[model samples]
Target: MIRIVSLLLVGLLLSCDEDVLPKPNSFLRLEYEKATYKSFDDKEYPFSFQYSKDAKVIEKKKYWLDIYYPNLNATLVLSYMHVKGNLMFLLKDAEKLTFKHMIKADDIQAVPYENTQSKVYGKIFEVYGNAATQIQFHATDSVSNFMTGALYFYAKPNYDSIMPAVHYLKKDIVRLMETIEWKKEEYF
Candidate 1:
Protein backbone atom coordinates (compact mmCIF):
# COMPACT_ATOMS: atom_id res chain seq x y z
CA MET A 1 0.00 0.00 0.00
CA ILE A 2 2.84 2.45 0.83
CA ARG A 3 4.51 1.75 -2.56
CA ILE A 4 1.24 2.54 -4.41
CA VAL A 5 0.76 5.74 -2.31
CA SER A 6 4.32 6.89 -3.12
CA LEU A 7 3.72 6.35 -6.87
CA LEU A 8 0.49 8.36 -6.74
CA LEU A 9 2.27 11.20 -4.88
CA VAL A 10 4.97 11.33 -7.55
CA GLY A 11 2.39 11.59 -10.28
CA LEU A 12 0.60 14.42 -8.48
CA LEU A 13 3.85 16.37 -8.05
CA LEU A 14 4.69 15.99 -11.76
CA SER A 15 1.28 17.31 -12.76
CA CYS A 16 1.59 20.24 -10.34
CA ASP A 17 5.07 21.09 -11.65
CA GLU A 18 3.76 21.36 -15.19
CA ASP A 19 1.03 23.71 -14.07
CA VAL A 20 3.53 25.96 -12.27
CA LEU A 21 5.75 26.35 -15.30
CA PRO A 22 5.12 29.60 -17.14
CA LYS A 23 3.53 29.52 -20.56
CA PRO A 24 5.43 30.80 -23.56
CA ASN A 25 4.47 34.30 -24.56
CA SER A 26 2.76 34.81 -27.89
CA PHE A 27 4.24 37.24 -30.45
CA LEU A 28 2.37 39.46 -32.84
CA ARG A 29 2.95 39.24 -36.58
CA LEU A 30 4.44 42.57 -37.60
CA GLU A 31 3.09 44.21 -40.73
CA TYR A 32 5.81 46.47 -42.10
CA GLU A 33 5.19 49.47 -44.36
CA LYS A 34 6.96 52.54 -45.69
CA ALA A 35 6.82 55.70 -43.61
CA THR A 36 8.21 59.27 -43.70
CA TYR A 37 8.05 62.56 -41.86
CA LYS A 38 9.57 66.04 -41.91
CA SER A 39 12.40 66.99 -39.55
CA PHE A 40 11.18 67.78 -36.06
CA ASP A 41 14.01 70.28 -35.75
CA ASP A 42 12.84 72.64 -38.45
CA LYS A 43 9.68 72.37 -40.49
CA GLU A 44 11.75 73.51 -43.45
CA TYR A 45 14.26 70.66 -42.91
CA PRO A 46 13.18 67.74 -45.08
CA PHE A 47 14.21 64.62 -43.16
CA SER A 48 12.35 61.50 -44.26
CA PHE A 49 12.57 57.72 -44.10
CA GLN A 50 10.62 54.47 -44.59
CA TYR A 51 9.47 52.60 -41.51
CA SER A 52 6.61 50.42 -40.31
CA LYS A 53 3.22 51.94 -39.59
CA ASP A 54 3.17 49.86 -36.40
CA ALA A 55 6.23 51.76 -35.24
CA LYS A 56 5.77 55.18 -33.67
CA VAL A 57 8.17 58.08 -34.10
CA ILE A 58 9.10 60.18 -31.09
CA GLU A 59 11.16 63.23 -31.84
CA LYS A 60 12.54 64.39 -28.52
CA LYS A 61 14.22 67.47 -29.98
CA LYS A 62 16.07 68.67 -33.07
CA TYR A 63 19.01 66.29 -32.57
CA TRP A 64 17.36 63.27 -30.91
CA LEU A 65 14.64 60.94 -32.16
CA ASP A 66 13.33 57.49 -31.22
CA ILE A 67 11.38 54.90 -33.15
CA TYR A 68 9.49 52.57 -30.86
CA TYR A 69 8.70 49.19 -32.40
CA PRO A 70 6.14 47.33 -30.39
CA ASN A 71 6.27 43.57 -29.93
CA LEU A 72 3.78 41.49 -27.97
CA ASN A 73 2.53 44.88 -26.74
CA ALA A 74 5.99 45.84 -25.47
CA THR A 75 8.01 48.74 -26.82
CA LEU A 76 11.38 48.11 -28.44
CA VAL A 77 13.29 51.38 -28.67
CA LEU A 78 15.53 52.38 -31.58
CA SER A 79 17.23 55.73 -31.22
CA TYR A 80 18.82 57.87 -33.94
CA MET A 81 21.45 60.58 -33.61
CA HIS A 82 22.63 62.95 -36.32
CA VAL A 83 26.31 63.68 -36.13
CA LYS A 84 28.91 65.56 -38.15
CA GLY A 85 31.49 63.94 -40.45
CA ASN A 86 31.26 61.12 -42.99
CA LEU A 87 29.78 57.70 -42.17
CA MET A 88 33.12 55.95 -41.80
CA PHE A 89 34.55 58.72 -39.66
CA LEU A 90 31.53 58.79 -37.41
CA LEU A 91 31.63 55.01 -36.94
CA LYS A 92 35.32 55.09 -36.03
CA ASP A 93 34.65 57.87 -33.54
CA ALA A 94 31.75 55.95 -32.05
CA GLU A 95 33.86 52.82 -31.62
CA LYS A 96 36.54 54.75 -29.80
CA LEU A 97 33.99 56.55 -27.62
CA THR A 98 32.09 53.36 -26.75
CA PHE A 99 35.30 51.55 -25.87
CA LYS A 100 36.44 54.39 -23.66
CA HIS A 101 33.13 54.52 -21.82
CA MET A 102 33.07 50.77 -21.28
CA ILE A 103 36.61 50.79 -19.92
CA LYS A 104 35.85 53.64 -17.58
CA ALA A 105 32.70 51.95 -16.34
CA ASP A 106 34.64 48.72 -15.76
CA ASP A 107 32.34 46.98 -18.22
CA ILE A 108 35.09 45.30 -20.20
CA GLN A 109 32.74 42.40 -20.83
CA ALA A 110 30.44 44.77 -22.72
CA VAL A 111 33.00 45.14 -25.51
CA PRO A 112 31.31 45.11 -28.92
CA TYR A 113 32.11 43.24 -32.11
CA GLU A 114 31.85 44.53 -35.67
CA ASN A 115 28.97 42.28 -36.65
CA THR A 116 29.10 43.37 -40.29
CA GLN A 117 30.32 46.16 -42.60
CA SER A 118 29.06 47.63 -45.82
CA LYS A 119 31.70 48.11 -48.50
CA VAL A 120 29.12 50.30 -50.19
CA TYR A 121 27.95 52.18 -47.11
CA GLY A 122 28.62 51.59 -43.37
CA LYS A 123 28.97 49.03 -40.55
CA ILE A 124 27.15 47.47 -37.57
CA PHE A 125 28.51 46.81 -34.08
CA GLU A 126 26.74 44.46 -31.69
CA VAL A 127 27.32 44.46 -27.92
CA TYR A 128 25.85 41.80 -25.67
CA GLY A 129 25.54 41.69 -21.91
CA ASN A 130 23.60 39.98 -19.13
CA ALA A 131 21.08 42.80 -19.20
CA ALA A 132 20.63 43.69 -22.86
CA THR A 133 21.98 43.52 -26.41
CA GLN A 134 22.76 46.73 -28.27
CA ILE A 135 23.17 46.87 -32.03
CA GLN A 136 24.54 50.04 -33.61
CA PHE A 137 24.80 50.87 -37.29
CA HIS A 138 25.94 53.81 -39.40
CA ALA A 139 25.19 54.70 -43.04
CA THR A 140 25.22 57.58 -45.52
CA ASP A 141 24.39 58.23 -49.15
CA SER A 142 25.72 60.96 -51.41
CA VAL A 143 22.87 60.79 -53.91
CA SER A 144 20.18 60.45 -51.25
CA ASN A 145 20.99 61.66 -47.73
CA PHE A 146 23.90 63.92 -46.83
CA MET A 147 24.06 63.50 -43.05
CA THR A 148 25.79 60.71 -41.11
CA GLY A 149 23.53 59.03 -38.57
CA ALA A 150 23.72 56.23 -35.99
CA LEU A 151 20.97 53.68 -35.33
CA TYR A 152 20.75 51.94 -31.96
CA PHE A 153 18.53 48.96 -31.02
CA TYR A 154 18.23 47.83 -27.41
CA ALA A 155 16.69 44.42 -26.67
CA LYS A 156 15.57 42.88 -23.41
CA PRO A 157 17.88 41.14 -20.92
CA ASN A 158 17.42 37.56 -22.09
CA TYR A 159 17.63 37.91 -25.87
CA ASP A 160 16.90 34.22 -26.49
CA SER A 161 13.37 34.60 -25.17
CA ILE A 162 12.71 37.51 -27.52
CA MET A 163 14.69 36.26 -30.50
CA PRO A 164 11.75 36.23 -32.89
CA ALA A 165 10.70 39.80 -32.15
CA VAL A 166 14.31 40.97 -32.11
CA HIS A 167 14.93 39.46 -35.52
CA TYR A 168 11.82 41.06 -36.97
CA LEU A 169 12.68 44.45 -35.54
CA LYS A 170 16.26 44.24 -36.79
CA LYS A 171 14.97 43.71 -40.31
CA ASP A 172 12.69 46.73 -39.92
CA ILE A 173 15.63 48.83 -38.76
CA VAL A 174 17.62 47.76 -41.82
CA ARG A 175 14.83 48.95 -44.07
CA LEU A 176 14.75 52.27 -42.24
CA MET A 177 18.49 52.68 -42.73
CA GLU A 178 18.12 52.08 -46.44
CA THR A 179 15.49 54.78 -46.84
CA ILE A 180 16.97 57.53 -44.64
CA GLU A 181 17.23 60.95 -46.33
CA TRP A 182 18.67 63.92 -44.49
CA LYS A 183 17.68 67.46 -45.19
CA LYS A 184 20.13 70.05 -46.54
CA GLU A 185 21.67 72.22 -43.82
CA GLU A 186 24.26 71.87 -41.05
CA TYR A 187 22.18 71.71 -37.88
CA PHE A 188 25.40 71.54 -35.94
Candidate 2:
Protein backbone atom coordinates (compact mmCIF):
# COMPACT_ATOMS: atom_id res chain seq x y z
CA MET A 1 0.00 0.00 0.00
CA ILE A 2 2.88 2.42 0.71
CA ARG A 3 4.51 1.84 -2.69
CA ILE A 4 1.15 2.31 -4.44
CA VAL A 5 0.56 5.66 -2.65
CA SER A 6 4.06 6.90 -3.61
CA LEU A 7 3.45 6.00 -7.28
CA LEU A 8 0.09 7.82 -7.19
CA LEU A 9 1.73 10.94 -5.72
CA VAL A 10 4.41 10.88 -8.45
CA GLY A 11 1.78 10.48 -11.12
CA LEU A 12 -0.15 13.47 -9.70
CA LEU A 13 2.99 15.59 -9.69
CA LEU A 14 3.78 14.67 -13.32
CA SER A 15 0.23 15.52 -14.40
CA CYS A 16 0.46 18.92 -12.69
CA ASP A 17 3.78 19.64 -14.49
CA GLU A 18 2.19 18.78 -17.84
CA ASP A 19 -0.31 21.58 -17.43
CA VAL A 20 0.81 24.36 -19.84
CA LEU A 21 2.07 27.59 -18.36
CA PRO A 22 0.05 30.68 -19.25
CA LYS A 23 1.78 32.68 -22.02
CA PRO A 24 3.11 36.13 -21.32
CA ASN A 25 1.34 39.09 -22.93
CA SER A 26 2.23 38.86 -26.62
CA PHE A 27 1.59 42.56 -27.29
CA LEU A 28 4.57 44.72 -28.31
CA ARG A 29 5.59 48.12 -27.01
CA LEU A 30 6.60 50.80 -29.57
CA GLU A 31 9.29 53.41 -29.16
CA TYR A 32 9.16 56.75 -30.99
CA GLU A 33 12.67 58.01 -30.41
CA LYS A 34 12.80 60.84 -32.97
CA ALA A 35 11.27 62.23 -36.13
CA THR A 36 12.92 61.96 -39.57
CA TYR A 37 11.81 62.97 -43.05
CA LYS A 38 12.96 62.16 -46.60
CA SER A 39 12.19 63.05 -50.21
CA PHE A 40 13.23 61.14 -53.34
CA ASP A 41 14.66 63.24 -56.16
CA ASP A 42 14.04 60.60 -58.82
CA LYS A 43 10.28 61.14 -58.73
CA GLU A 44 8.50 63.82 -60.72
CA TYR A 45 7.06 65.35 -57.58
CA PRO A 46 8.47 66.01 -54.15
CA PHE A 47 7.03 64.39 -51.00
CA SER A 48 8.24 64.57 -47.44
CA PHE A 49 7.23 63.36 -43.97
CA GLN A 50 8.43 63.12 -40.36
CA TYR A 51 9.07 59.47 -39.53
CA SER A 52 10.88 57.28 -37.01
CA LYS A 53 14.42 56.12 -37.84
CA ASP A 54 13.30 52.52 -37.54
CA ALA A 55 10.49 53.08 -40.04
CA LYS A 56 11.14 52.10 -43.66
CA VAL A 57 10.10 53.87 -46.87
CA ILE A 58 9.05 51.38 -49.50
CA GLU A 59 8.81 52.60 -53.09
CA LYS A 60 5.90 50.80 -54.66
CA LYS A 61 5.97 52.82 -57.87
CA LYS A 62 7.78 55.81 -59.28
CA TYR A 63 5.38 58.18 -57.54
CA TRP A 64 4.14 56.18 -54.57
CA LEU A 65 5.70 55.58 -51.16
CA ASP A 66 4.71 53.04 -48.55
CA ILE A 67 5.96 54.37 -45.22
CA TYR A 68 6.18 51.52 -42.75
CA TYR A 69 6.00 52.87 -39.22
CA PRO A 70 7.44 50.18 -36.98
CA ASN A 71 6.29 49.63 -33.43
CA LEU A 72 8.14 47.46 -30.96
CA ASN A 73 5.02 45.29 -31.01
CA ALA A 74 2.71 46.69 -33.76
CA THR A 75 2.75 48.06 -37.32
CA LEU A 76 1.51 51.32 -38.82
CA VAL A 77 1.55 51.55 -42.61
CA LEU A 78 0.91 54.70 -44.61
CA SER A 79 0.92 55.14 -48.36
CA TYR A 80 1.58 58.47 -50.02
CA MET A 81 0.73 59.07 -53.67
CA HIS A 82 1.16 62.35 -55.54
CA VAL A 83 -0.59 63.22 -58.75
CA LYS A 84 -1.29 66.40 -60.67
CA GLY A 85 -4.50 67.37 -62.45
CA ASN A 86 -8.11 68.20 -61.58
CA LEU A 87 -8.48 67.58 -57.85
CA MET A 88 -12.00 66.20 -58.10
CA PHE A 89 -11.05 63.99 -61.03
CA LEU A 90 -8.07 62.50 -59.26
CA LEU A 91 -10.08 61.83 -56.11
CA LYS A 92 -12.72 60.05 -58.11
CA ASP A 93 -10.11 57.97 -59.83
CA ALA A 94 -8.61 57.07 -56.48
CA GLU A 95 -12.01 56.11 -55.09
CA LYS A 96 -12.59 53.75 -57.96
CA LEU A 97 -9.09 52.38 -58.21
CA THR A 98 -7.74 52.33 -54.67
CA PHE A 99 -10.54 52.81 -52.15
CA LYS A 100 -12.77 50.33 -53.92
CA HIS A 101 -10.09 47.69 -53.74
CA MET A 102 -9.84 48.15 -49.99
CA ILE A 103 -13.59 47.88 -49.60
CA LYS A 104 -13.61 44.73 -51.69
CA ALA A 105 -10.87 43.31 -49.53
CA ASP A 106 -13.10 44.00 -46.46
CA ASP A 107 -10.52 46.28 -44.91
CA ILE A 108 -12.94 49.22 -44.82
CA GLN A 109 -16.55 50.12 -45.37
CA ALA A 110 -17.85 52.08 -48.36
CA VAL A 111 -18.48 55.55 -47.02
CA PRO A 112 -19.25 58.76 -48.89
CA TYR A 113 -17.42 61.98 -48.29
CA GLU A 114 -19.05 64.55 -46.01
CA ASN A 115 -17.99 67.89 -47.43
CA THR A 116 -17.35 70.59 -44.84
CA GLN A 117 -16.20 74.17 -45.33
CA SER A 118 -15.31 75.43 -41.90
CA LYS A 119 -13.68 78.73 -40.96
CA VAL A 120 -10.35 77.00 -40.54
CA TYR A 121 -10.26 74.96 -43.75
CA GLY A 122 -12.35 72.79 -46.05
CA LYS A 123 -12.30 69.11 -45.20
CA ILE A 124 -14.26 66.56 -47.19
CA PHE A 125 -14.60 63.94 -44.52
CA GLU A 126 -14.38 63.69 -40.80
CA VAL A 127 -13.11 60.16 -40.67
CA TYR A 128 -13.32 58.87 -37.09
CA GLY A 129 -11.49 55.76 -35.94
CA ASN A 130 -11.00 54.80 -39.52
CA ALA A 131 -8.59 52.12 -40.63
CA ALA A 132 -7.58 54.44 -43.46
CA THR A 133 -8.05 57.96 -44.78
CA GLN A 134 -7.35 59.39 -48.23
CA ILE A 135 -6.88 63.06 -48.90
CA GLN A 136 -6.57 64.95 -52.19
CA PHE A 137 -5.56 68.51 -51.56
CA HIS A 138 -5.32 70.92 -54.46
CA ALA A 139 -2.21 73.01 -54.70
CA THR A 140 -2.33 76.67 -53.69
CA ASP A 141 -2.37 77.57 -57.36
CA SER A 142 -5.18 75.02 -57.87
CA VAL A 143 -3.23 73.75 -60.87
CA SER A 144 -2.18 70.45 -59.31
CA ASN A 145 -3.47 67.86 -56.86
CA PHE A 146 -1.48 66.47 -53.93
CA MET A 147 -2.72 63.11 -52.76
CA THR A 148 -1.58 61.37 -49.57
CA GLY A 149 -3.35 58.42 -48.07
CA ALA A 150 -2.71 56.35 -44.93
CA LEU A 151 -3.71 52.82 -43.98
CA TYR A 152 -3.70 52.21 -40.22
CA PHE A 153 -3.68 48.71 -38.78
CA TYR A 154 -2.70 47.23 -35.43
CA ALA A 155 -0.03 44.63 -35.91
CA LYS A 156 -0.52 43.16 -32.48
CA PRO A 157 -3.92 44.63 -31.50
CA ASN A 158 -2.64 45.31 -28.02
CA TYR A 159 -3.85 48.84 -27.38
CA ASP A 160 -1.40 49.29 -24.53
CA SER A 161 1.52 48.33 -26.73
CA ILE A 162 0.84 50.52 -29.77
CA MET A 163 -1.31 53.49 -28.75
CA PRO A 164 1.54 55.69 -27.61
CA ALA A 165 3.61 55.14 -30.73
CA VAL A 166 0.58 55.65 -32.95
CA HIS A 167 -0.32 58.87 -31.20
CA TYR A 168 3.17 60.28 -31.77
CA LEU A 169 3.33 59.16 -35.39
CA LYS A 170 -0.10 60.64 -36.13
CA LYS A 171 1.30 64.10 -35.48
CA ASP A 172 3.77 63.52 -38.30
CA ILE A 173 0.94 62.58 -40.63
CA VAL A 174 -0.91 65.78 -39.80
CA ARG A 175 2.25 67.79 -40.40
CA LEU A 176 2.83 66.14 -43.76
CA MET A 177 -0.72 66.89 -44.84
CA GLU A 178 -0.54 70.52 -43.80
CA THR A 179 2.90 71.14 -45.34
CA ILE A 180 2.72 69.47 -48.74
CA GLU A 181 4.60 71.36 -51.48
CA TRP A 182 3.95 70.01 -54.94
CA LYS A 183 6.59 70.10 -57.68
CA LYS A 184 5.84 72.52 -60.53
CA GLU A 185 7.07 70.19 -63.26
CA GLU A 186 4.53 67.85 -64.81
CA TYR A 187 5.51 64.22 -65.36
CA PHE A 188 2.67 63.22 -67.65
**Top candidate by lDDT:** 1
Best by TM-score: 1
lDDT of model 2 at residue 147? 53
Q: lDDT per residue, candidate 1, 61-165, as tens digits?
A: 554456665533334343434444454555566566445434323232322212123212454444443333344555544333333333333543554555455
The CA lDDT of each predicted structure is 0.48, 0.46
Query: Per-residue lDDT for 1-188 in model 2, tens only?
Result: 99999999999888785657898867455565667665434454454334545567677776676666555433333333444556676556555544443432334333332222211121222122322332222122234334535445545333344446556755655554444544544554
- TM-score, model 2 to reference: 0.48
Candidate 1 is scored at a TM of 0.51
Error of 2 at 67 (Å): 0.6
- Which portions of model 2 miss their true places by more than 4 Å? 1-31, 38-50, 72-85, 92-141, 154-161
Clashing pairs in 2: 28-73
Candidate 1 Cα misplacement greater than 4 A, ranges: 1-46, 72-89, 96-120, 127-131, 141-156, 186-188
